[model samples]
Target: MTAGDPGGLDFWSFVELANRRLAEEYGFKHQLATELLLTLNRASNIVTYDLEASVHRPHGLSWSGFRLLFVTWLAGPLEAKKAAELTGMSRAAVSNLAKTLVADGSLNRESGVRDGRSVLLSLTDAGHRDMIEVFREHNEREDEWAGVLSPEEQRILVMLLDKLVTSRDQFDVRGRN
Candidate 1:
């Protein structure tokens, strides 16, 4: 399907087609391509897209921008590199977004004491206020998404995801030898 096609297949439909094609044409393993990783990727995209549309966009923030504010608000002052690590963003990306946030008065950046080359980031008073307000609505969206699964299922899913993340070094992203 073309990128501009309104009738383009939904994500799972594309995944299903890929799974079949891989199995038939390349003799790939069905379980590996169609199961855990694809499902997690799809869910992550949908959830992020919905959150951006429903909560972040109305507040004049992109999801990543909001996340930067949220992390700083929750963690107090942190070096830009630290913020990038905590937010799962690249250092350059965090630095760039920080520039906009600083200009907008949502965050403060100051030279680091321990390192002359580093900058520490913290929420400004206005930034803290805005993030707190936005977070209340963000939590509501989270609740709506979590409502799809029962509490037990939610707990189990969290545990499973944690397991995978914590064991990330075990997985080889490049082709296995």
Candidate 2:
């Protein structure tokens, strides 16, 4: 099976084979699929390690919780739908997590200005301090832990990740099975 000569292939195998064929056909190719999988996996591990090394100790901010919170920090005072879109999480998941964070006093939610139907979300005072502490400790650990990677390497890695995210839209991977 080749490009445009597609045969039966499930999602997993299809992506794998496509990556391989892409390298062979186009040459000097990046393993887009494997790069994506490993990038997510390595990121998860780094976050986990950083969280465990947190100095202030656990404050009910699991990795998933932190994920929701981190997005809020990045694009806060946002409507629920927009937050979900930025985090790449489902609206229901965002809503549910928002409820939990609100109850924990780590998030503040109110009615959206433009959309009466939408709810705006942001970090509460508690959430703000918590996020700052978490990130400070996390960044410290990152600097010490990832010391092997030079500044240029880190910059290159970030550029590659950004490129991969943008490339997904151009791939047209729908209904490839």
Candidate 3:
């Protein structure tokens, strides 16, 4: 029943033993499962923080910048408000990011045909190239992170995550408490 024995005492079982030690030896109040969940949340946050830091660019772009690039890359030659609707971002955000991307020459923006005041945005050749590189790097990073899983497992994981994200009842903007 030691850790050296494969089936005798596995990783999860070792966690159980440690849980017992904490509760029995030190008179810890919380249940083992609660403690485990808290530990899992902390680990998840730390990993996300590290991953974000690693992926951060010093080019003065925020998460909104990346998101704007993605939406425009997908649906460019698109109206500014239309891009905002598609991306689920605010009109102001799209307006500002579109201006920045236009300034950087990554995107092309012109006055709308129907409305002189309205703007339409499209990806320039450089924008497409940058998007291709970004997507390639993103795919490589995803593969590296999920390399332990088979392709089928990865598909299933994506399916499950998508379901969770798209389910309306799961989202709550305000805290219940």
RMSD of each: 4.5, 8.4, 7.9
- The digit string of per-residue lDDT tens for model 1 on 72-130 reads 99888999888888888888899899999999899999999999999999999999889
Which ranking of candidates, highest lDDT first?
1, 2, 3
Lowest summed lDDT window (length 10), candidate 3: 51-60
Model 1 alpha-carbon drift over 4 Å, by segment? 1-14, 171-177
Model 3 vs. true fold: TM: 0.58
Native-vs-model 1 lDDT? 0.88
The prediction achieving the highest lDDT against the true structure is: 1
* Residue ranges of candidate 2 with Cα displaced over 4 Å: 1-57, 173-177
- The residue ranges of model 3 lying beyond 4 angstroms of the native Cα positions read 1-61, 115-117, 169-177
TM-score to native of every candidate shown: 0.86, 0.67, 0.58
Ten contiguous residues with the weakest lDDT in model 1? 1-10
Clashing pairs in 3: none
What's the CA error at residue 10 for candidate 1, in Å?
A: 4.9
In candidate 3 the C-alpha lDDT for residue 2 amounts to: 36
Question: Each candidate: what lDDT?
Answer: 0.88, 0.77, 0.71
Candidate 2 on 74-131: residue-level lDDT in tens? 7868888888777777888898999988999999999988879999899998899889
